[model samples]
Target chain A: MEERISLSHGSGGKQTNNLINDLFIKYFNNEIISEMNDSAQISLDGSKRIAVTTDSFVVNPIFFNGGDIGKLAVCGTVNDLAMSGAKPLYLTSAFIIEEGFEIEKLEMIVKSMADAAEEAKIQIVAGDTKVVEKGGVDGVFINTSGIGTIYENTNIKAYNAMAGDVVIVNGTLGDHGMTIMCQRSGIDIEGELKSDCAPLNSLVDSMLEVCSDIHVLRDATRGGVAAVLNEIAEMSKVSIELDESSIPISEEVKGSCELLGLDPLYIANEGKLCCFVSEAYANQVLEAMKKHSLGANAAIIGRVIEQVPQKVYLKTIIGGKRIVDMPSGQQLPRIC
Target chain B: MEERISLSHGSGGKQTNNLINDLFIKYFNNEIISEMNDSAQISLDGSKRIAVTTDSFVVNPIFFNGGDIGKLAVCGTVNDLAMSGAKPLYLTSAFIIEEGFEIEKLEMIVKSMADAAEEAKIQIVAGDTKVVEKGGVDGVFINTSGIGTIYENTNIKAYNAMAGDVVIVNGTLGDHGMTIMCQRSGIDIEGELKSDCAPLNSLVDSMLEVCSDIHVLRDATRGGVAAVLNEIAEMSKVSIELDESSIPISEEVKGSCELLGLDPLYIANEGKLCCFVSEAYANQVLEAMKKHSLGANAAIIGRVIEQVPQKVYLKTIIGGKRIVDMPSGQQLPRIC
Candidate 1:
């Protein structure tokens, strides 16, 4: 491990994993956390199960095109619970605001958080606010923790991916990451460039109704689809192959990524998820997902394979294959 | 409300309450949160109940005398759950770390957090880490959200205090606030003045075992015992009378507060808690509390009265009575 922490440590990629494995997992070692699905599953009353997850949003600009920090904070935790195949029930939000921040902006953020919670169909049942001296913190940071009830007979897990499962993504990738990047860089892009940030619990519920035997459900957030696939492959001890042409990408995001020399596959998306289901239920799940507004562009992007265990391969448009390695360092800091 | 958020808004005093009532409560209002209890109690599977609480620690100088940010984070959430008459089960920690922080320091903090969780008999099941630019955050700020199972027949709450209920405190006051204040001011006090930071779940369990009908249980933290009593009085719509001579205080802390011109009633404490119980079970509860190491200095300080609703009075040593008003503003910022 490095002697001092770096921006890469929070990039939600290789360095972040190293920090978790070396420090967090080493000390906070427990059966639940060791599994490290999107959320920790806990059994209550012998049979009932619940999912819990936490995330701290430090997005720069605080306000983006489509969503602000408050909305992102709510959607982030809600999506994590949804990724665990759970119906998000309640959320707790804690804010650390820098002293002298505008009360109007704070109210706006809080209002958006309430709005987002209502949209997610979850209640913000507990919250705390702390104000730090100016220069002690930048703007405001929100940490949200969510609780959800797991559906019976639903066994969604990263390690549950099988060799013959089909991989699907709800919508376009990298819109969120690129939107933040472009906004930060002051890059004037043609057409609309907005964050794909929204609550996925409802969309997840729709898909679960179609197929309760889904293998794995993961929201591709910080480290994006690439990181999620890598983790799933390693956890399930299977290989994943993605069809580059089949992955959904908005024209504006694709253009932005190309101009900025970034990979859409590894850029963050708040509303998008990578779903793994058996081939028999793949079409049915895709149809159900596409029915939701958040998943209108749902597509079959990849599949799990028996060959090359724990590896991820992408078949390019020209039919050449390339490895999609886990991101090593920070590409953009504070991009949520 | 102020145009800008001041340090007073997070001081856990009047300003803090104004901010909460005007903003957070106004927007995030719900049945559980509207109660304004230390933790929100949620029912699961009809009969079973659980408590949830969230707190963010931004103590300056990360490392304090008796505890650091990590231990405080864990204890803060665990104590909240305990205050709700629940057995803390799981905690989700989210860390916002500044760039270029020492990895060794983070490891030490994480280790202490793990140790605290083990001592509290709770598991740190899920966690998230986010890194901000060096100036974006001060050293490290930790937010911990906890879940606990409510004890059977437990009806503890802030508003449960009745007219004849007796009030008791577990230990000395202002140790934590004074420790941090002196540390920041570079005061070299003679005797030991460490923070009274410890997990009180075990102590609470013992007390609950002794008397299950405990009324109000609250940890005197950020705003100290005075703030807690004031809130309780208002929540329960009853008056409280504190016998000045009966309150427990360490000689060293008393001397330091005298030298600093700080009131022990308004100073923060990390481990101490205020208990309100019926007079019939007060002695048994005190005895149970005294049996625990953290509650060795337990004392019956006051009793609830119907003379004046929503008021708290302190009887002086010289036979004079004075109202202990809610603190108007910040006394010691970042004291925990």
Candidate 2:
């Protein structure tokens, strides 16, 4: 029953309340949010540790083929907190919306955000909205700040990637970036391939439950896998050897990357993660990941090692060795 | 000897360090920032209470008449924490710059940011940078998150505005917004009535040191006095009355308002504060403010009363009482 977004949508008026209650609250049905207060107040256990992370999304083409900016904003922040080995509990979303955008689209985006938050089990607590003239804004810009509770028993960081730790990926890389690219370019393939954009906390929870020794948990986003590996190497002061044959890539994704001159390693991914674990428990993490729909393509593609300090090397199918470097510049702009 | 901000400024390269060091660190001149890192770290006494506040500045034109976005970002966040009766300690600045911005301007902005932070006696701690395409971004946007250490006995909220509490203004309002407007409109004026964009932390600190009976503190921004008072009323669930003759308005500001057909009450102020204090200590706080250059015109303009719960009423110069209301729509777009 929502019409196109009028200026009142952000006016903190009837339209604002209606939009929040009818769509946002309806979809993101949760205890804390039901009150619709300025911020969500929840009790924090003194024994539980807390982690904070903030991320901004300037994704162009707010509404894309498979997903929209709202969904991306929620999933992106939630995933970041999850990768830090925290159970994301609260989020603050600040929106920079351009004037003259449609109301229906606003509702759709808000609904998507609510749905994503609901699925992720996080409360969209505090939010701020500022609008600029039509030309001054790029449709919508979102900054999501997440606060999560970290269990006292979990000690996770890039520095924990010890020698011989196995690198496990929850699913195929490039699915997210490629999907956005294809959709933006209006490419229609025989089989539909949308972005694998979902909350990865549950999948991450599974792995943590199975292997408490998970060393490094990283989401392959922005600079992607190569950048993540480089970060781990730099922090852990060790190298990683990735076997090209062991890495998993979908045929569609491989074809898309090959055609677009994109390296799958550098392409961003969502609803997927690159985790490191001790070789002894690598299989256990992989097994837990395979149990989740989002992690159906889980694989043990590499291992941390003592050779070549602070580097990542990949073996090629043709038996060639090449450095898998951290992405020097943005690979695909606005892919997330 | 700093070069301008170019694409290399955010390339995580040498240029970035030079800008941060030569301009930012130099102006900041803080021990913590002198040795540059991803974030500024500080060790605070565990016993001191802390106050946290975050704010984002997206002021347009990047450069305004008397200030820029960089300066505004730091002052705004620090002031928020200070208004909460805290002594600001550290700040985090995040920049979202558009590609192809001038490097020289970027350096100036960074220098301005550091200068403002230092002037406020707060250190720039953590930061982040993201770039959008030429079409996707404005010149730049800055977000500052600040944390302050609150003294054990300092606690002030709007709800504490008891009946007969005195309402005070740190200085004349409408200067900042008018300066921005004049510059944007290319209005030439003689004698240079500059924007009052100074940090109010020192004033707050001095007042808190002398007078611990302060009931409420607020920065009159966006909707200026109207917005801030309404916030206090709602939070305190109290009513307030303003004497028109007591409210300080600069002659130039009044002239500009008349010419522009704008209401001074609804204009924005970046450097001024609206405070409610117990009548006993109101004069003491006002005396402290008058010592600072920014608060030379500070005055006790109103008083709180237990009538018409949560409303602000103003007595016009013509001896008529009119209820003052917060502007439902934004009066100034992106005015920090």
* Best candidate according to DockQ: 1
CA displacement after TM-score superposition, residue A272 of candidate 2 (Å): 2.1
Among these predicted structures, which one has the highest lDDT? 1
> How well does candidate 1 score on lDDT at residue A294?
89
lDDT of 2 by residue, B1-336 (tens): 322212223212234344444433443344433423112223223343445455556777688877899888888877877777777765555556666666457666777877787688766543444556775667777766655556557667656788889999988878888887777777765546567777888888888877887888888766778877876786678899999999998888888888889988877888888888889888888899888776789999999987864689998889998898756533556665
The digit string of per-residue lDDT tens for model 1 on A1-336 reads: 899999999988899999999999999999999998899998767788999999999999899999999999999999999999999999999999999999999999999999999999899989898999999999999999999999899999999999789999998999999999999999989999999999999999899888899999999988889988999888898999999999989999999989989899999999999999999999999999989998899999999987864699999999999999988888688988
- Cα error, candidate 1, residue B18 (Å): 1.2
Q: Report the alpha-carbon TM-score of model 2 versus the true structure.
A: 0.80
Q: Chain B TM-score per candidate, please.
A: 0.98, 0.84
Q: Give the runs in model 1 whose Cα sits over 4 Å from its true position.
A: none
DockQ of 1: 0.89
Report the lDDT tens digits of candidate 1 across residue range B1-336. Answer: 789999999999999999889999999878878888899988757778989999999999799899999999999999999999999999999999999999999999999999999999999999999999889999999999999999999899898999779999998888999999988889989989899999999999999999999999999998899999999988888999999999998898899999988889999999999999999999999999898999999999999987854699999999999999988877678877
